[model samples]
Target: MKQGFVKVAAATPDIRVADVWHNCEEIRKLLSEAEKEGAKVIVFPELCLTGYTCQDLFTQDILLKEARRALERIAQQTKNSGSLVFVGMPLAVDGELYNVAAALNDGRILGFTTKTFLTNYGEFYEMRQFRQGPEKARVISYEGQEIWFGPQLLYQAEEMNELIVSAEICEDVWSPVPPSIQAAREGAVILVNCSASDETVGKDSYRQELIKGQSARLMAGYVYANAGDGESTTDLVFGGHNIIAENGTILKEARRFTNEMIISEIDISRMLGERRKNTTFQTAKERNLPRISFTVNLEETRLTRRFGANPFVPQNMEERAKRCEEILMIQAMGLKKRLLHTNSKTAVVGISGGLDSTLALLVTAKAFDMAGKKRKDIIAVTMPCFGTTDRTYHNACLMSEKLGATLREVPIADAVRTHFRDIGHDEDVHDVTYENAQARERTQVLMDIANQEMGMVIGTGDMSELALGWATYNGDHMSMYGVNASVPKTLVIHLVKYYADTCEDAELRAVLLDVLDTPVSPELLPPKDGEIAQKTEDLVGPYELHDFYLYYVLRFGFEPGKIYRLAKIAFEEQYDDETILKWLRTFYRRFFTQQFKRSCLPDGPKIGTVALSPRGDWRMPSDACAAVWMKDLENLTFNKTGGYSL
Candidate 1:
């Protein structure tokens, strides 16, 4: 599998109770189906070769013999499948019956991972028919084949080293210590569970959460295949709730009672990266378990997993509102502490009527409220320069007055012209110097005012701007404290909107809503017909795409190529491959080259997992070259079908 993505499936095929031949045929059909879909790893429910509802039939000698025969048949059926398959069955070892998951690949039985925990409480009578497996792994002869049979068998792909997998049958995962935990510690990136957990009143939700929690705890991919309909409903009904999760997120889940197959590509590289970053997740001190090597065709896995376009913001309305509230509180609390610690008399904010400044001002007001300081002491400065629009300026002044902050209107056009003349620069010639002069001039004004009033200049530059190095150095970049440093541009929009929707003051709400609608601009260049010119997105690419790139690049250390692939999937409908590739290249170039700006960032609260604060999460050499990353993007060639190939 390329990119460390292995397509895995959890299939729950309908089975007949105690009918080994019928169950074997169903398993073969589902195996073929999953293989046809290019699944490299597939899992089935526990004891599917002979249904879990067999009761006394599980102990019959004929049933056990037929199950072994069915196992051999399933193994033979995988000759041309080129997939590592795990199917459940019952086996008789040393005259003791044990339920186990047999690992099969390329026409042979690789190993058998027996269920370690037997369920005996409540409606489960697994202990009656099966005993616990061995504490330690051991090799055994089954029909002249020396197969590894234990709970600690790890099936590793010979092609992709990161595609190591392990299995635990039904009750083992429910136990305090799952075998998969040790399996993960011993270098298993993917864990599969062959489960026959029947449905109860609220068990499905609990089961889903359990599987998600286990994957999150171990930092591995988890695939669970449960028993479905067609099994005799002798008191317990099988729902066949198949699920595939990767690192706490469910990638694909089968509907209950459908007995369907759920498949998704698990990013093994991401999991490995997370594990490497997490220092507390220690591996086993000693490696004693057997490692079984399996082979699969090395091809690019067609990803079925969905990557959210906005990783910083939640998708659900309720969750997003809650997240916005929590983030706002975090911002306010951080500012509140800075204010109290410094005993500052005022919090100065440059209100531009843009999302970042508006959020900064809101946070300042909240911090003032939290610190029991007078709101009038918070100076909200609106610096009108060449690019200031009537709409934005109006909103800025109104919002400041409504929030009870002392509004100050400072017109800086003449000041910028004087500075240009001093530098022997033409006032008419529009260039970076022209734009940066206005920015630096505004910053100079804010800093001097803060110094005069014993206040702190709250930085309004967001995480997106810092990531792209979009802010002017020593201008908007330098502040005493930055409340929105970790907040991304895409998230800033939502946060402002959330405040507008929740605030009780009608004038402030209207101003916020209008500010949210205004185009994001620095207002450094001259305006055209009173409308704002120099739209940021037209020059720097869309913030949504940049934010996505930033999240994956910093959060997971994903390579540029992988990030491109995920971006294509996330924004497939909105952006084409060439556009995504263009923006992605720009993102990497700016991110690497702009480290100098982030190397000396001011103190800011880290709100999310991804941050660029130099004193905290990220530290890099300012001169580090992005050639390697750019080269990865260069390798991606657009094809006629509008897809890219590396």
Candidate 2:
């Protein structure tokens, strides 16, 4: 019931063939349960009141009269329930019978959307009994009330925006053009289907896929309830399958052949945003569409769908491997083209044995190979300064040699010492200037060497770095072409390991595995007693939290409060509420203040869905005000070093 979120359900109730009274009772019971669950709209199977398998019995006046009477009973039972229900039944319209999904709510029939595509092939002989429905809706008298009955009928929720719902019959969805598509164009946020699709070998998967794709195509919430476990087994098997999906994602699904109710909240906000962003979706809006109006009470709904803390990273191992392979190829191929197009035989990459640099160097090797150049053409430069660690230094040199790249070390301590003297800053003071001086000096060395060698300077800074403005402008931030520009820090580690695991060299793989295990740091400050200092997370925020913030902020344009709400669920075990909010504030502050860095980013491949490349996804002004965002975060009240404000 939340603004832009509507609770919807797909219900498959067990029933007997030709049992109108019994089936109507089951519908009533399910309606009561769904309403209690705060479901605004619930859908049942096709011809559910009279049962889809009631073959020749549909022609009998008694069965047809019973179905009409049962529809009345179901409609009457909805008096105490607030849910808009879509239950299937047989209907006689203009002296012809058709399968219709009647919309019932608050003891009244809102409308009936009849099936347009009557199945007449194979085990399905729907056309034998019922004929195709008309395209245009017409008013009909049902239970002493006039209601619209046809394919194009939309229910408008009186209390909610974008909570409009519509219904379609079984074969209507299987038609060349689904009613869901038109329903969406007509502003129906929710599309319910009453399906009595008989199960066959591999039919469940196809049914599932069809519904999911339609939801995605329409950018609407799709609730599919199929008839199951009941009806005649003569030549057809009905395995009741139910699913609730939004934006192509199936949030809740029942086991095939089981009578169950699947419910989930549909974030119309996300779908609406996607449709607005895609031009094809916008074109669908221009066509004139007919709609039947219905309404529901507006109230806040509880979130049921689980949010992933690391949405960028896949949860399953198989998907993760696939994603890792795909992203690695994308990165390498991007760099490959840049090198071949520029006719550069050598690539200049600054390596510190850190994740970002290591990934960049690997990509350079792949790019050179793709360009039909030797690996040594990649000029791997390790600039050791005040913060350089022996472990990373050794690893950088080893990694370069292992990849057959030309390893070169340039000590920047002497040059930074001179720059420190010029800036009148003491080397003892570890500040932004101290760190940025080493960064800029290293960049100068790489750029000049690239110019001398006639190569491209590879950039190691990732999207996470760019989001926080972690790089020094015209220093590490500048490069000829950045392959990891769109890659987030959370994903960079995974991609590196993915490349490592597939390497033919075991030693190289072992070293990469260790690098993956290493803590993330710029390593700008000198080590404290041989231990690495200046861990990036300690200064800014955890990449996990910041990545979460960046994703929701840019991907969905979610408000800070909504993002915070989702974060609690996503990171429940890893982080508490207070900790999440604290880092969230940090993310907003740094992201706003660092836009100046992103404004002048060098050429980089857009690798992911969310990117802030000046020429790509994000084009914000460097000086945009974050005052309002920061103020909202700052005002978040928490307990005294405890959990959220309870």
Candidate 3:
């Protein structure tokens, strides 16, 4: 697979009770389908060769002999399959029967991992037919070959060393201490469970949570295969609830009672990255667990995993709302601490009726409320420069009044004109100087006003701006406390919208809605026919794309090429390959060159996992070069051959 994304499958094939030959054919069909889907690792339910409901038939010599022969047939089928398949069967070792998962690849058995925990409760009679697998590594003869047979066997991919796979039976995962726990501690990044779990009143939900939680705690990818239709439902019913999860997120889950195969790409690279970052996830002295190394054809895995266009923002509405509320509280609490610590009389925030400033003002008002101070003590300043439009200015004035904050209007056109005259610059020539001068003047007004009122200036720049270094240096960049510093621009709009939906006052809601509708800009360039000019997205590219790039690059440490691949998939309908590559190159260039602003960032609460706060989450050298990143982007060809020259 390409980019450390190993395609894996959790398959549940319909089984007939004690019909080993028929089950082998079913396994063969599923294996063909999975291999066609480009899955390198495919797992089947526990004891599927001889159905879990076989009851007393499991002890029959004829049935055991047929199961072994079926396993050999499946092993031979792997000669041309090119994918590793894990199938379940009963193995007799030293006159004791044990349920085990046999790993087969390349015309032979890679290894056999016996189930360490056998269920003996309620509907399960596994312990009656089998003994507990040994904890230590051992060898057994299978088809005249010495096979590693134990619960501590790990099948390591020789090509992809990070893709070490381990197996456990159904009850083993539900045990107090799963074998997968030690398996993960021994560097198994992917854990497969050959499960014969029967569906009960609410077992499916609990099973899903168990799989998700274990994968999260272990920081590993988990594949669960359950027995499905055609099994003897004498006392219990199997639902075949197959699930594929990676690091707490279930990528694909099959419907209960259905014979289905769920194939999804598990990001081994991301899992390993998370494990390395977590200091508590320690690796113990290797149990000297016998490892079976195998090789697979190396090719770029066509990723079937979906990447969200906005990773920073939650896709679900309820989740997004909850996240927004939590972020608001963090921002408010951070500001409240500053207000109480400094004993400031007022909180001054310059508002342009844009998303970031509006969010800052809202958080400031909340901080004042939390500190048991009057909202009027929060001063909302609206500075009208050369390019200020009627829409934004009107919204700003109305918002401050409705929120019961002291509104201050400072017109800066005259001051800017005087300064330009002093510098002997033409007023008609619009350039970076013209734009930055207005920003500096506005910041200067806010600072002086805060000093006059015995308060601190609350910054409105967001994380997206910090990443792209979009703020004017020493202008809008400096502040006493930045509430929205860790918030991204894409998420800032949602925060404002969340406030609108929750606030009971209709007028405040309407004004916030209008502010959300306004074009994002600095309002430094002159207006055209009284309309706002110099849109921020037009100059710096879309904030959404930049935010997407920022999230993957910072959170997952993804390279430019990988991010580009994910972006093309995530934004296929909205943006084409050319547009994605164009903005991606711009993102890399700006992000590296703009680290100075982030290196000296103001105090802000780290609201989410991905943050640019220098004191908290990110600490990067400002002088680091972007040459390597840029060169990778330049080399990307972006064609049908998976977008790279390699």
lDDT of 3 at 211: 99
Q: Write the per-residue lDDT of candidate 3 for residues 385-485, one digit (tens) a residue.
A: 88999989999999999999999999998999999999987999998889888999999999999999999999999999999999999889989999999
- Over the stretch 1-646, how does candidate 1's per-residue lDDT look in tens digits? 6788889999988788988999999998999899989999999999999998899888799999999988989999889677999999999998899899999999999998988999999988888889899998888999998989888798888877778999999888898988998899999999999999998999999999999999999999999999999877879899999989989999999999888999998889999999999998898989878999998899878887788999999999999999999999999999999999998998899988888999999999998998899999999999998899999989999999999999998898999999999999998889999999999999999999999999999999999999999999999998999999999999999999999999999888988988888888898888899898889999999999999999998999999999998899999999989899999989999999999999999999999999999888899999999999999999998788978878
Residue-level lDDT of model 2, residues 375-468, one tens digit each, is 9888999998887788888889899999999999899999999988997999999888999998899999999999999898999999999999
Question: Which candidate leads in TM-score?
Answer: 1
**What are the lDDT scores of the predictions, listed in order?**
0.92, 0.85, 0.90
Identify the leading candidate in terms of lDDT.
Answer: 1
* Candidate 1 vs candidate 3, TM-score winner: 1
RMSD of candidates 1 onward, in order: 1.0, 1.8, 1.5
Candidate 1 residue-wise lDDT at 164: 90
Give, for candidate 3, the lowest lDDT window spanning 10 residues: 637-646
> Which sequence of candidate numbers ranks them by lDDT, best first?
1, 3, 2
Supply the global lDDT for candidate 1: 0.92
lDDT of 1 at 271: 96
lDDT minimum window of 10 residues, candidate 2: 283-292
Candidate 1: stretches off by over 4 Å: none
